[model samples]
Target: MRIKNSTVVITGADSGIGRATALRFAKKGARVVLASRDAAALETLAADCRRRGAKALAVQTDVADPEAVEELCESAVGNFGRIDIWVNNAGTGVFGPFLDTPLEDIQRVVDVDLMGVVHGAREALEQMRAQGEGVLINVASMAGIIPQPYTSAYSMSKAAVRALGVSLRSELRLARVKDIHVVTVSPGAVDTPFFDHVANYTGQDTRPIPPTYSPDKIAAAIVNVARSPQRELTVGLIPKAMVAKHKLFPQAVERRMATLTHRKHLKATQPAPPTKGNLDRAAGDDATGRRGRKTGGHGGRTKTMARRLLVIGGAAGVTAFAAFRWRQ
Candidate 1:
């Protein structure tokens, strides 16, 4: 589909992959509608897009609220006349032992991560069906495919999101609706405010796991998927490999991932007090950070750790083939 002059709506436009994606679509000449709980950030991003020579609108929205999401859709149509692409990029996480994490925090994660996507998809599909063509992108995570310890709710929500995509596609196919598409984007640990804003119950500060990719990488994949709709896209090579390995050795991969989550994923040296990190509210603008701060520089040691995990956790014989085939 031609991006130029297309109307695209992106949720979570305040930061991370969503922010990058909004800019990308704008540069491609698409009119962008930005949504987030952070109205100030959304407006700032919208202005940036406008400066890039594309029309932009900012809508303050809480995706967990169905009414608000519906209004977001209405706002898009009211302004642009039609919706060409809708991206459900807003997400939050809760990190800590399952028992230690607050039940309310877990519920909030599911509400924002899983139900948020469902709300967006439902609203976007409504507009798409009427318009006769559109792309609905849901930003899930590798955690959906491979469970990450200390993130039971996050993992469960993401897995549900993946299943939502599959079920939507099946329904679309059975109904012979070919133009409207549902695409799921699963990225590895991305360099985003995700870690910064995640509710952490652990005594240690939380960080992205090793081998994290830039949000731009995921943004690029999102644009590519928009151009040529696919059922799903996983962003990084390591994540793709991990997903494939998980399919073959679920128990082994889960155990290894759990170990990694306990050790490397949390910063033992950096003690942090527990806070309800942006679950009920928005984080400060600085939470997004510059590119350099995003991954906090995983360094050689973490990279080596990632590689070793792959080597030990994957089935030696089929690992390479599975990873290769997954990409194809």
Candidate 2:
């Protein structure tokens, strides 16, 4: 589909992948509607888009809310006359042992990361069916394909998103809606404020940030998907390899992950102060008043040790697999 002159609605547009995508689309000559719970940030992004000579609107929306999503769709169609693309990019993460993680945190993550995508797709489909031409882009993650230790809830949510995309794509085809496209983009670790916002179950005062790719890298992939719809697009070499390895050698991957697991780190006994400066708070969604305050927990020597071991192990596994594939 041609991106020029199309009207697109992007959730989580306050920052990160969503914000980058909004800017990219606007720069590509598409009218963009930036939606997120953060009114101020949304306004700033929209203004930036306008500065780039593109028509833009900021809609303060909590995608987890069904009514809010409907309103978002209405506002976009009302203002722009049609909806061409709907991007479900708003998401959050919580890390720690599944048993130790707060139920509230789990529910929140599922609601935002999974149900939020569902709501966006439902609203987009309703409008797109009428127009007979639209694109639904769901932003998943590498975790969706290969579940990681200590991030069970996030992994589950992303896996569900991948399933949702596949199901929706087939349903759309069966319904004979050739113009309505459903695409999923799975990105690896990205340089976003995601780590800052992540709920920690380990009770650590601060969480360690992982190696990351730029948000612009994923944004470029999303633009490509919109232009030429695909079933799925995996971002990053490591993540792509992990997905392929999991498919080809599930047992080997499972053995490696288990061997790399940090059992000692899982026992974070001392609760430190909670962390602060998460993107959620930055976006002004600190409704719980927990913004800018540490959540709690001291650093765990064992946890750090475990992370290092996993990194080394993962690298070794990837190298071995790559060599084998090259030889083949």
Best by lDDT: 1
TM-score for each candidate, following the candidate numbering: 0.91, 0.82
Instruction: Give a tens-digit lDDT track for model 1, residues 1-328.
Output: 7799999999988888899999999999999999999888888888989999999999999999999999999999999999999999999998889999999999999999999999999999999999899999999999999888889999999999999999999999999999999999999887777777778999898877777777777898999899999999987667776776777779998999999988878888999899888899987765334243536675212446567566456545466766777899
Determine which window of 10 residues in candidate 1 has minimal summed lDDT: 285-294
Residue 228's C-alpha lDDT in candidate 2? 94
Error of 2 at 254 (Å): 3.8
At residue 5, give the lDDT of candidate 2. Answer: 97
> What lDDT does model 2 reach?
0.78
The 10-residue segment of model 2 with minimum total lDDT is: 287-296
Predicted candidate 2 versus true structure: per-residue lDDT over 1-328, tens digit per residue: 8999999999988877888898899999999999888888888888989999899999988877899999999999999999999999999877676887778778878888999999999999989999998889999988788777777888899999999999999998888778889999999766555655666666653333234566778888999899999889997655666676787688887666544434422324546454322324443553212112221232111225565576567767867877888899
Error of 2 at 136 (Å): 0.5
lDDT of 1: 0.87
Model 2, C-alpha of 180: deviation from truth (Å): 1.1
